[model samples]
Target: MTGRELLRMVAAQVCVHGVMTGTRLAAPLLALQIGYSAAQVGVMLALFALSPVLLALSAGRLADKHGLRLPMHLAIGGATLGAGIAAIWPIFPVLCVSALLTGAAAATTQISMQRHVGRAAKNTSELKAVFSWMAIAPALGNFLGPLIAGVVIDHAGPEPAHEWGFRAAFAVLALMPLITLWLLRGAHEAPPEPSEEAPADRSVWDLLSVPQLRLLLLVNWMQSAAWDVHTFVVPILGHERGMSASTIGVLLGVFAAAAAAVRVVLPILSERVPEWGVVLVSTVVAACALVAYPLTPGAVSMGVCSAVLGVALGAVQPMIMSVLHQITPPNRQGEAMALRIMTLNFSSFLMPMLFGSLGAVLGVSGLFWLIGGLLVVGAPSVKGLRVDETPHERPGDPR
Candidate 1:
């Protein structure tokens, strides 16, 4: 693909992911609108995540073997349709089903894009920069999604305004995948070669022979769990603290803005900072911030904590992808990345439910504290990732 086409693809993905990030605001309120309990919301989140978990590997393999455009088109259509359905009538059960459809669409988009990024990128540094910048769209989306959704939900007046609220929000989201499908059309297809270990019988264990791959995958899973717990926990926390839906929306916006800002500069900064050091220090600090969040006096204090935590959350994806690109060859990148996504997503299902149930018993403060401790536990595992594993192109020098 030409550089222009590549950039167009990236732009399209930004829109797609931006809407995806923006839609995060929709779910909590959608739960509330439908009168689903916190536990049910957690379950819905898990079930949604599970769709991606199940499909991630196969999606990646398919992208590698075929063209990204076709699967990407399908995924975008699915997401658009799913968003449309969820907005229709907003019943509790319908929303849950919408979660499943949305999750599948999101997972497919992820795999298709990653495969394209790997294929289209000219070098390791460019790849890292692209992935890091790719994250910026989500942060911007987060800011936009909740702020807009909140206005529609809180201020929009008519009969059945809540339904109007989500319909408006989802209508915006449905537009994103079309952009992705259109942009993907311009991308040059790079079909992957059969792997050296392409035997039909290769077990997951056998396929994951690289030591770094295993470690990275596991750390990412833990990271995902902690991240998800915070996502579900934050809204519930706000409810307990008596914040309105609009206020919660603003906080989510701030958090996402912080995350986006950090990610925008990450690729440039990675050259100067150690890759593992970046991940480690940020994660540790984020954990401390999260631990303090619920204990804070009120919304303002917690908002500060959430923003700090967002800064840390922003650091994760590019750094992890950098490390992944470093160790895995291009041909295996698809499967490896797919596995990483799957593991992260599978954890997304359980962590929210686990944390929410515990919070019901222990209270929000206790839940945050527990999640904080869990983040602490995760920090060490990720912190120690060997720098020697970095790809030769962008060896993030620790010093």
Candidate 2:
């Protein structure tokens, strides 16, 4: 794809992701507005995350067989419809259902998007650059989604009006998918290049048996958990340290901003640092930041830790995608991508509950130390990763 085409595609995908993220964030808030307990809100979030896990493989298979075009259309349509229904109904059950539908749709679209980018790449350079560019979509979406939802709800006035604000946010999110649809119009997409080495009848288990792929998943999951824990733990730690809500929010915002900044420099970094080296350095840096996070004396110190953590965590995604594509067969790239998504969503579903309980018992400080410890234990998983095996190149070749 040309630079202009890549930009247009990224813009559309980012908007759709923004809608999904916005809608996902709004659903739990809507449930809370209607008087649901925190436990119930957690359940709703779990259901949303769990939907992606259950459907990921099927979605990948569909993409591999039929290509991303039809699946993207269907997934985006479901997402749009789900948001519209939540907008029209504005009730808890409808909101839960909306979350599930949107979640499934978003997962499918992401797999398709990965496959789409994989198709566009002719070498490791393009793959790393493209995937790095794609990583910005979610970061942008995650930031925009909650910000838009919060702004709309705030503008809607006091409690009763705030309910309408949530509804309006969903309405607004629903419109983004339409823009994605428009972007899809008249745009030519490259189909994935067929691979002679990929068997036509590979099972999901077959893919998992590869040692390097398993290592990739492990590294990917560890990094994903770090990202989640940082987001979840920072506010709690900040509050414990007597920081105001706004101060903590700004700290989180800085972390996010740092992440976005790192992506801009990622292509250059990828060129110099091998993929395995990047993952190893990021893991070590993230662990160091986590150790510093709970021990920071004040907001400024904590913000510095958060920014370092964000940069470390931020550099991970594109490398994972590039390595994953390298290890899997070209034709089965969708399944490989799905496996990565499945592991991440699985982490999303389970980590919060596990860590929340741990935090309650051991305190947030203990929890941070525990995460750092776990990263230390798992450090060897990435040790086996072959940094020289650039995606789109044959094994052991120095191309």
Candidate 3:
């Protein structure tokens, strides 16, 4: 892809991501004001993730069979409508429906864009650069989304008024994705060429049977669980700590900024260290960060811990995407990306409810400790990514 096209794609992603992240944070807060318990909050978030988990593979197949543009358009429309629904009604049941729509739309839109970028790359170098660039967009969104929502919520002040604050936040964010359509106008990326030798009946299971791909997906799930827990738990933790809504948002933003800063130099970091090494270290750092997270006595300490956790978790995505693309069949790259999304959303779907229930009994600190322990248990999965087995390079080739 040309630099201009890449920039356009990233610009579009920033808006979509902002809505996704902003809504994610805002939704729970809204539900709490609506008088939902922590377990209820988990159920609400699970419903939000349901569509994405169910539809991810099909969305990928559609992108592969047709083109990226249609899916992108559909995604933007669905997300916009979903956000508008939440803004208009501001009820738990309606918010649940909104979550489903937004989740599916965001997953499809992201898969389409990822497929487009994967198709555009000419080699390993370009793939690394593009994926790294793409990573920064989410970092920006993660920061801006909640930051904006928190300020609005804080400004609204107190219960009933702050409820309107959330409604207004969703309404404002619903419009952001419209900018994506404008940015991507006239942007064209042809689908990947068909492979004549490939069998027509190849199934997802066949793809999953690959040891490395399977291992990558599993490790990805572990890391993704860590990411989800932080997003879900932080606001609750902040609220319990007597912090304001804006401080909670800033805490999440700090994590995102640290993540973005790491991605800014990821290409260079990947060159110096193998992908496996980076992932392994990330897992350890994430474990350590999670352990420290609940121990923070105040917001500054919590922010410091968030930055550390962000750095650890942030480094994993681009590396995993680059490696996953390298390992999968060229024509099935879209499918592989969908599978990744499925894994992520599936984790997003259930982990929150599970953790929230645990937090209700064990408290937020115990929830953090449990997540940290899980990360340590899952860290060995990263070792499965042998450098020699990675596609597109020699065993000792520097990434």
**lDDT for every model?**
0.70, 0.82, 0.82
Report the lDDT tens digits of candidate 3 across residue range 1-399. Answer: 898999899889878877777787888898887789988887766765788789989888778776688888888998898889989999988888877877777788778888788778887767777888888886777678777777776676465348778888888889988999999888887655545134567688877777888899989988888888899899998888899999998998898788889988888877677788889999999999999988889999999999989998889998888888787766677788999988887777678768878888988888889889988998887888754643453111223
Compose the digit string of candidate 2's lDDT tens values, residues 193-229: 5343445556888777777888899888888888888
lDDT rank order: 3, 2, 1
Error of 3 at 202 (Å): 3.2
User: Candidate 3, clashing residue pairs?
Assistant: none
Model 3 spans with C-alpha error above 4 angstroms: 22-42, 84-94, 146-172, 194-200, 232-250, 292-302, 357-369, 387-399
Poorly placed runs, candidate 1 (over 4 Å): 1-7, 14-46, 83-97, 141-175, 189-197, 239-245, 360-362, 387-399
TM-score of predicted structure 2: 0.92
Q: In candidate 1, which residue pairs clash?
A: 46-349
| CA RMSD per model (angstroms) | 5.3, 3.2, 4.9
Mark the 10 consecutive residues where model 1 has the least summed lDDT: 390-399
**Candidate 3, position 58, lDDT:** 84
